[model samples]
Target chain A: MTDTDSTTTGPLGPDDITADSPFTLPGFFDALAEGRLVAARCTECDTQMLPPRPACYGCGSRAVTLSEQPRTGEVISYTSVNRPPSAFEHLAPITVAVVELDSSARLTGRVEASLEDVAIGDRVELRIDDPETVDIDPDFDLSYEEEWPAHVFELL
Target chain B: MSTAHLIAVGSSPLGKTDLPGRDLFSKALAEAFEELPDPADVVDGLYVGAQSERYENQIMQGTLMAEWAGLRNVPAERVEACAAAGALALKNAVRDVRAGVHDAVLACGVEKMTAGGTEGATNALGAAFERALEQRSGITAPATYALLARRYLHETDATERDLAKIAVKNHRNAADNPRAMFQQAVDIETAMDAPDVAPPLKLYDCAPVTDGAAAVVVANDEVAAELQRRSDAVRVAGIGSAANNLAVAERDLTFVEGANVAASTAYEDAGVDAADVDVAEVHDAFTVCEALLAEAAEFAPKGRGIETVEDPEDRSAGWTDVRINTSGGLKARGHPIGATGLLQAVEAYEQLTGRAGERQVADADTALLINEGGVADAHTVATVLTATDGGA
Candidate 1:
């Protein structure tokens, strides 16, 4: 077996990860795996944060709890990286986009399609893909849902 | 809202100065204090603006500057916001004096970027971006501005020649500035054909990483009246600041919203329009930044800033009307981040006082200074300065 193959596990098991390692999929990833996106809601300010931080950037309150988030979102803006860093060498010419979650929380991720199909206001859905094979893994992949087919723009 | 007057303006030689930011600051402070008619008088407060503490490893910079400048007992605070650190520090000093808390204060900005290598300094600047989203994506300041330059060219009629003309004009202006980092002139062709640092941004299009410091002493109207009896004084009419998202992807790439907001607020406070500005020292960290800022600040109409720079009629003799970056700006003046904002203020002080020998705008009455801390879309500060002896 090759080194690449050795690193590419079918699915990460609980024993293969740790809390300190960013690669260890956090609790949010567990929810994402179940098709339920999660965010953190501050108890004091009712502010929702996706890919949740330990404290609220808005009100600076640590009293926050995990809550379910809308899996659908609209693309706020995006850019195409013709050249990427070493770790993402395999992912050059990729389109990265900022998506405003249906709940109004913003998060960024790699859009898994041609750049032409993506644009501001394009609808996107959170989907899971094996992180081991991608150049820069975000623990999950993003793809357009079937219902928003007309909104997609094809990359030239 | 409060009245603050510039009593003294001085700088350590700005170039490839071998001294660190602290040392450069000390030299400039010594000169400023010596220039004061009463050098022994105690200052009520001190403010210093620095962009990065990661390289300097010196947190609590205000205390450090006060100690080094021999003002141990004075209350000192460091104001940081990327390149606009010094401008914001001056604004804070103005606020303190206006509130009747302090009558006299010293504001200084210093940056020692050369102590670290090029890559180290570049990475330190990248810290201003969103760590997880933008910085991690390999988007440095140059690349971010390059993306904007591309978009501006596509949406508007700007070309590489238009951008190069800004560099040529600033370089010629710098030739007359004795303290400018680059005092040599270059043709438009030389600027346009320089090596590419990032796509659409040539070597001449970017400011060099520099080490320098600038200081200005601010006082209230009473103190200003006293200073006028002794020497020339420049009065601060208005100050404004605005903050935007750290990530470039979050906003429109072609325009700077923070600059527009800050300029509008300052103009409103000064009760003057863009047409009234006799001279302006704007942030030109990149060539395109100056053009976009001119339009966004209403100094020129949208997409017409390029024409303003390129048109010979707009830059005729004895005209100097609406002069932008007369001191070469950060593009050729050297951008020692922390000191950049203060340097711009110093340029205005010199222009208004007729002390800027060769580069002086004839009979200047009102001047504006705009300083930005991060990339075009980040933190920005704008201030208006008027000659105390001159009229509206």
Candidate 2:
């Protein structure tokens, strides 16, 4: 019952959920730019939220901290986007996965692997959205240079 | 402890049409006022639901519909929560009556999805998602729910066949409805053979892009006592609404937590349980929706919700046996966004009064409706309706 390791930012966070923004897929880009996958963890109940959150999904607490996530996760479910939206027309036939992390929380990211190789329980490691393999939507015309995150996963 | 009473229910044909949004809304409103007791029962308030204001190029729809539908200069407002807009609009009007603010109120909704092409409508609807994950990643409505459908089968051992059964059942039910878009019954074989829109979700598995309107008139208990046509009114027993984090990945995919909260609140307010719901009109934009919502409404247990919907080949154990979606649901009856909620109200009124033709649930005493906004984009409104004489 000695739960006083609240200040440590390594896995178990010490910041409040409200103090810093939860990484909504759009908001997560800042951290991703620095090569980190962070999640918002409830400071009070120790619940973690991937794609970050304003409140804890486990205990409904607003006292959450944005903490870095483990690099590994298991595939929960996946689909091949044979027909993608117009924004991603160039990236048609992308592979998507709902990856549940070993540490805490689940997130959806594109999986770069053979469709036959990926299974429900297969493990995958986080990979950055590299331009070589990653095809981004055309944002050539815009007032603001928007960064649409395309976080990917490599089959373990 | 008095609840609002539904004095009249009205809807027009549910299908693709060239009618302007105002005209569609007015048509349903006019149909609703057909049996008004008297001019003295003036509509003092108007609430309209339209999911995509941009689609119609019309804003201030509540005011416009109120004027075009024959009532002008009354308090009016428009509400939107994607597919749940109509349900919420009805709830707002019901609340107006409940709050003792107006003797009678009109709640209505309309959507003209066909006016815009399929791509245009899809984009308009996509405005309802959490832009961060869903839109940014190219996940559309059907695809989003497909995630749930995929996860449901994963957890429950249910098959795509189970989902097909729901589509078949709804199509069968819609065949009896003249106002329904697709009145011809769809067989399980046809549903199974339809092209997949998203993996695990066939084209038949999704509610089509429809255009229609529906309206309901509600009055306070005191106003109900004086109405000329009060004999057939159904009491608005209870209403509950709640939402979850808009992030789809973080939430429990198997369970619709928001519907659970909303339905629980509505049940408590209505002083009834799942057993008391003789019929239910749920927001089944996709087949998986009907499965998840059945569980949220407590029509079935956590793991067994899909079992409530029988195999398409077997009618004995189908959802109709339990009287769910006796109106064919969003699947076959058609889903016209804002109008769908009031369409549920219309169906519930018809069944409760024993006026439903072929799709009627025999001796239906109470009804439950679950109208949802977007794919768990965080809003759910649950309403329970009953015959005036049925409950305390």
Candidate 3:
């Protein structure tokens, strides 16, 4: 229990719902901070939810289990945010993409590449970095999110 | 079950206005109730759609707007679904009247998007996207839709120019609409050359941050007959709403399945088909949305939605004859977030009643309105309105 556990075989019960469980945001980030990208694999519909959740949206089932996800994926679609939110204004003209991981769990993240350089179907690798080191405004984080890691992608 | 009728509709000036949110609501309310009786006399319930408390730092909009309209006590409440809020308000009102809960209900929406400048508006709207993964990645409204546009172009015969033409067509329609924010038409070349808010989504491709409000009155059959002439009222024949994935990454990039479900549900409820619609006001918040929604609403065949720019005769064989965004849509009419869905209803009301002068479609008896919030169809409300006399 000392190590952040990202894998769980489920049909989870109320006792299993705690901060240390990957089903909650705190536990999900805890595992991510330790370099384990976890997803809630819905037993009912096989839908993969990144940063695991308690319930499955695909088929409305609560029988979700955690599985560590592969870091590599391909870009399904991409864009550049010329004007981003105020918290990320310093990083304007940010290139972002929706990447489907090797496990087929899709997530959107900032890409460490120029807008002109990325294309659909391009291979990329997910990278987790400490939030403070990412140059994002500290005010962007809520009190609980201050220590959470930020994710980005680099073209392969 | 009682029939829900849209008896009257009104809107405030749609643009950068000095008026605050409540005052804007007053403007819209004044017009809606001008010919009819006082709000309290005509309606027994109220619903107000307001997108954010960030602008003007206000909440309890339902109470505030109801008070502004001179209604003291009633079952008034606020509703929110980002951009789809306005229509959600109308849907609630319709449901109440149809259920015999209220003889009449006032459905209105207002937003003071200009209260904060562009930066403030950006941050306020940023709350609409999925926070955990999408917003953390710095995805703005245009950027998320750009993902859909980028993939749509890759999968279909649509080009950047084809998308630009959507802006052109909507602008042309807007020029003819007296209520549009941008009443000046832009050619395809200008739209194509516009600055990129996000790649695949140029400045013209996006709807402006507008300050506006709209109000619609929904009444039962008996109430409608007492308040207005039969020809003046439009029947709220059907309404359907759906919430899709909050994250844009998880949705179908090319097709808006949720909108399709909502529209199909509405079409079924109305006992009509896509072909029966004579005019439509789909959420053209972005140029690409017009095309995507046309396909989603079943007005155009799959991947041929870009043909929305073409005249009905010139479009694909499977395309419906419905003219889209005749009130300039969100692209030109002005999108004031919470007020947009009601604005679509305003346009439909005007068209169904033959009040749309310059941009009026011939025999536009049946109308469809699709209002979407968040990226793509994360939330969608589709309503169908038919002329009371069936366009006799």
Candidate 4:
């Protein structure tokens, strides 16, 4: 239940501990490579962390486990970006969605659904990003979209 | 507690210009100083609220801003709080004067967005939101605000027509403002039918990419008395600032919580209610903001800010006495990001001093300026300003 011991593959010393210790973005990608979705879940209040953070946004609890994320969520909001910035100029008219996962954590990802099929409260499920399709756009520069803009949700 | 007053104000034109950011700031400042009798000798400190360094291709801009403005060796500080950067500078200036650190301070906010064009401006502007969550999604400010606008429509039984009312009204108001960036007034049809930037939001619904600078001299009692003979000063009665959770979803999507908190703080500090406000400059970054912030500031009861737009004179119901965005707000006054907050201050000063000409409200005694950063989330800086004396 302690954050110190919850990491699955981290090799930490007795005093060494970190939030991204075992759960880096690459690690999230690793899990996705294995067809699984994982996020930090607080051991105390059960607040789920997406794009995981070191300190818990709720209750400031650091004792959390990088557990399997909920497969499904509901669309909370969406915007169809017709005129994206220079980094995303090629991907104009893309629909981005903010989804609340069943685990109660929220993250933004592209919704692989038609504007007609998707809505504010529509159900969605996490879909892994395709390595072949994800071009590492250096211009976005440390943006979550740079890392996971293609990591998306499917209408369910 | 000691009080601070806005003794002088100045602004560069709010529109596309070839001037560099520093020159715009200098011009605005030069105009501000021109209003004062003792100019540089009176300023003990300076705060510059400039925008994204990416646009200007410069860093550590305060010294350069002072140098460009011909300011000689005054203690200077740079303040940046996204779109509220200017307001933050003003807030710090007021605090400095009230704390007896400086007798007179200059707060300047300047931004040159047109230099980079629309995409460049969009990228720089997008940095105002949470980087980890919102920015990476390839969302522009219009797209982000449109999300709120859409949700607002669903929740409030309001339509695009209601939002258009803001665009129409602000434009109408700005038509009388000579310094406003957009002087042409638009009807509801013009607003609703303007080319789409983001659906449910159109070109007219959003603020234009403006290049401008605004500056104000905030001074204590002694300096105010000295400057009183030179210009009409407005009392900085109360100022309030608050921040909402960075994650927009964590707060109510329908209302701007930061604005509500900041407005309440300003109201409490000023010892006045919504009834006392004669004129207001709400941050109308987008049309939805006009509605959301007016309600958040409690100028209109819940779900009723639309009435302030739909019918400006129909204050018979719960819609209060305040006429919001008397300066056309960001929508028409022009939004130069960091400069916007100080621009609101400039506008409020104009309205209260009876110098606003056609844009002037009759006998405006008290005014409020609500400036915000982020898309419905993040910092809201609200300042309550009262005229030194009742105006004609």
Q: Which candidate wins on lDDT? A: 3
> What's each prediction's TM-score?
0.77, 0.90, 0.98, 0.91
lDDT of 3 by residue, B47-108 (tens): 99899999999999989988998887799999999999999999999999999999999999
Better of 1 and 3 by DockQ: 3
Please rank every candidate by DockQ, starting with the best: 3, 4, 2, 1
Please, what are the lDDT tens digits per residue for candidate 1 over residues A21-69? 2222354454454555556666677676655556665667766655667
DockQ per model, Cα: 0.10, 0.40, 0.86, 0.51
Ranking of predictions according to lDDT: 3, 4, 2, 1
lDDT of 2 at B212: 91
State the iRMSD of every prediction, in order shown.
6.4, 2.1, 0.7, 2.1
Best candidate, DockQ: 3
**lDDT agreement with native, every candidate:** 0.73, 0.78, 0.91, 0.79
As a whole number from 0 to 100, the lDDT of residue B355 in candidate 4 is 90
Q: In model 2, what are the clashing residue pairs, if there are any?
A: A16-A64, A17-A64
Candidate 3 docking band: high
Any idea what lDDT model 2 has? 0.78
- What does fnat come to for each candidate? 0.05, 0.32, 0.92, 0.55
Error of 4 at B278 (Å): 1.5
**Model 1, B1-392: lDDT tens per residue?**
35888888778788676787788998888878774664326468899999898667888989888878767677899999888898989988888887888888889998888777775677678777665445545555676676667667767888988888888888888998988989999998898778876656788888888889998898988877766643378888888899876656555667788899999999998898887898899998989898888877777767766654644366423332487888988888878888999999888988988888888888788998999977784899999999887832
The predicted structure with the larger TM-score, 2 or 4, is 4
For model 4, the superposed segments whose C-alpha errors exceed 4 Å read A1-49, A54-68, A142-149, B310-316
Each prediction's number of clashing residue pairs: 6, 2, 0, 0
Query: In model 2, which regions exceed 4 Å deviation?
Result: A1-27, A113-117, A130-145, B37-41, B311-321, B389-392
Q: Model 1: which docking level applies? A: incorrect
